[model samples]
Target: MKNSITPSVPARGPADHEVRDQIVAAATEHFSRYGYEKTTVSDLAKAIGFSKAYIYKFFESKQAIGEMICANCLQEIEREVRTAVAEADLPPEKLRRVFKVFTEASLKLFFRDRKLYDIAASAATENWQAVQAYEARVRTLLREVLQEGRQSGDFERKTPLDETATAIYLVLRPYLNPLLLQYNRDTTDVAPAQLSSLVLRSLSP
Candidate 1:
């Protein structure tokens, strides 16, 4: 039998980060239109005028690309949340506005672009570091709000800050979580304002 040799893959260079970003952007567009399950490395490469081999040089798999996209989306959400937190004065007001901003953004992003949301939700289950970091940032923001509320005599101090933040997250999860929001929309008739009021009441001093 004749011996066969595998061709060498291109080495990553200083430009790899830029190229990787380009690949991620193209992947985002394709995933948005066709969805994560349907979008493939081939589609991404073709869209970017590159080859599948080149894409593999930067990303190990399509899932990796999806993870990057999810991270980007979460980072965007975090920025919006931080802005909402900075602008509000009182803890209750901060909590309410933060919750409103997050829920509104979630609904707009998930419903308008469900495919990307689905990919993000799936990536979250795998506990990607980006997702974990984004989650931590949210928790910290919530804890800060709670601490401020306690100091200002706005929120009851019976519960620990961590516990209060956790409770608030859980209570509003159906609205914050993409999958849960989808389920809630399909299964129930409760409105976002109603849910907001219920959560705010629990935080009262």
Candidate 2:
């Protein structure tokens, strides 16, 4: 079912660790399949072949499991952003790379885990721990990249790192909306080279 779900968290570990991981894995699967409101503890437990009580011991509730799953997703997003930021050689280039990398990862995730994706998009407003941490981590990466750009005199906006990061988010945010998917399921609208050209032109002095 659904391409034979394979959980990222490993399976063979200490019994306790395996149980916890299995619960997380099961929750990820169910959430990816059914989303937040529809996914239930029993479904997760059955998916993992664990008793309901066993699941509770590892996670107090579905929301707890959700936070854990979101944390995992955030960690993944941070990794991708960090990679993109690390690879770029210039400020304008960094923004372009970050946008492309973030967009590709998001589109992949949006299809695989739409609810969690939405959860992250609204995390700033929802005040969810997972979302908060996720945004914080992304901001940290942005700051680091901008600091490098500052040394190179690449950023002329005089905006604080946080403001600039939010601005980037503003620029990239609309593409992640569900409606945008109808346009070639995450393609079209702006080809990478064109988007990069637009960003470079706007950001360059």
Candidate 3:
């Protein structure tokens, strides 16, 4: 009888999960220290004490590792914005808080780690999955805030929710997008409040 041979597959147990986390952690540190564009999967493997093939077992490529780091960084900004918005009692305040908090968070990130920020900038420019997902969440949040304002009689009910949200998102995009943020540094401190005020006036019922 002929023996049937099956291809070997990587195990997905707790140990494997730990190793994957370790790899991601290592990659994040490496990318933060040395810009993502200059790093290679082979370099990462050497830095992390793993073979290139073994690293591939955990992540498909260097970009996959970057995606994880980028997603985590974006999630942190989203969390701060969400928390600040939740703390405000009025819908207008919530909307203003969203702009203020998000801009502040982005600025903080840009200054703290320029190298890491470059990854986010690249992700934004490329419209990577992480950036797209982050943008969608922000849009949803804006829509919800507008809906709440209309229901509370603080905002006009004339404009459609999606359209209003998109409009506001476009206004905020320069500050929120990493790729465009560096150019707007001079206005970062004052722009969010001014823009939010302008938006609030338009929304006034």
Candidate 4:
């Protein structure tokens, strides 16, 4: 019988969140530079001076790291939208500001980094739950804004709050979708101001 070879596992490092943070930071650079499909655990480990096993200790897989980066990016987007919504007094103004903030931030985040955009695009298709969860958060934010509009007598809704929010989200899909944003760079079919007017009119009492 032939002798079997055993693979050696990397020794564990300090069991602190710092190690995880380092992994994520290094992974972000590698992912942004090399695109998601080309990046590997070994590449990340080599960049960080750790073994692939060490990376696995912090993140279950390369996909998990990608998910973390996506989550972080989405969180930042959410924070900007939330800040804009919170500061605006009028619901129409809040909706407009939120739309502007979301569009500007997303464009800056994705278009400025094509590799990141590619990763996000892949995640939207493959890791759909992450995308859905992010959308759910946005929908909840929209619902809150709609509720405020209703309370302020700015909106006369024939549909329920959740349904109305979903409708708004679907209506704004072209603007909110990253892939569509990338493809429609030169297109002038729908302007931001035009969409804002449509949304305001739709919501008006």
For candidate 4, lDDT tens digit of each residue in 74-139? 777777778877788898888787667777777778788888887788777684455667787778
TM-score: which is higher, 1 or 4? 4
- Worst 10 contiguous positions by lDDT, candidate 3: 1-10
Clashing pairs in 3: none
Question: How do all models score by TM-score?
Answer: 0.81, 0.71, 0.90, 0.87
lDDT tens digits, residues 32-147, model 2?
Answer: 67776676788777777888887777677777777777667756655776676666677777777766776777666656756655544444345666655555555556566666
Displacement of residue 96 (Cα, Å) in model 2 is 0.6
Quote the positional error of residue 140 for candidate 1 in Å: 1.3
In model 3, state the lDDT of residue 177: 90
Pairs with backbone N, CA or C atoms under 3 Å apart (clashes), candidate 4:
none
Better of 1 and 3 by TM-score: 3
Which of the two candidates, 1 or 2, achieves a greater lDDT against the reference?
1
Backbone clashes for every candidate come to 0, 0, 0, 0
Task: Superpose all Cα atoms of candidate 2 onto the true structure and report the RMSD in Å to 1 decimal.
Answer: 7.1
Best by TM-score: 3
lDDT of each: 0.72, 0.61, 0.83, 0.74
Model 1 lDDT per residue over 93-122, tens place: 778776777777777766788778768778
Model 3, span 66-100: residue lDDT tens:
87788778788887788888788999999899889
10 residues in a row with least lDDT, candidate 4: 1-10
Error of 4 at 71 (Å): 0.6
